[model samples]
Target: MTPEIAAEADLVLTATRAHRADVVSLQPKALKYTFALADFAHLVDGIDEVPPAQTGFFGPADDSFIGRLVDHIGKRRTAIHPIAEDDADIVDPYRRPPEVFAQMAVHIDAVTPPVVRALTLE
Candidate 1:
């Protein structure tokens, strides 16, 4: 996505636009997740609807599967890295990337629904 498009997407997800007033009060994390879930919706969006046919059928139930997925997806996806890691007491979202900033957007699209549901039930 172009920088303008990415910024626009962020605004929409964050409910900054007047047209999305119905969803404006959504939590920030939920908004982020919604963005991520939307990004990956084309791939494994239906996974949540059905339980796995077999737990370990795909691979061993360990870190490998997750690691592989992140590695594979993370490359094409834009990553948001910390601006600085040496300061233990600071929490700032001031980082930029040497590559494109697609990962954060992808992550936002991928993880939203469950996070929203979990918060709603709480």
Candidate 2:
């Protein structure tokens, strides 16, 4: 990933720990915002939900809600960091069989809800 892209990102998500490492290597500054998809879900298990917020009355709703969520995860990183680093990895199905791809899908599906809760309004 380009440094510029990483710089502009509000968050960086990867499917696996290795991919997350690559992103962090390229843009160390994003260490706070970068996360493996499942890893982030796992790490945030302890963080309380952040209710969706409305923007200023005069302005349009924007990405600030998401930014606030990302910030909370960053703030709690150390306390919950290592809990799932190894177990949270989603298997890569890049060149595997149909069954393997399906397995990967299941894995993703299982982990998606928590990530959604962590990042989305609904």
The candidate that achieves the highest TM-score relative to the unseen native structure:
2
Give the count of colliding residue pairs in each prediction: 13, 0
Residue by residue across 6-47, what tens digits does model 2's lDDT show? 878988889888988898888887787888888787766645
TM-score of each: 0.21, 0.76
In model 2, the Cα lDDT at residue 70 comes to 72
Error of 2 at 59 (Å): 23
Per-residue CA lDDT of candidate 1, range 1-120, in tens? 233443333223321122223343333322322222333322232333322223356654323333333233333345433222221111122476733246554444445664344223
lDDT of 2 at 95: 88
Measured on C-alpha atoms, candidate 1 has an lDDT of 0.33
Instruction: Score candidate 1 by TM-score against the native.
Output: 0.21
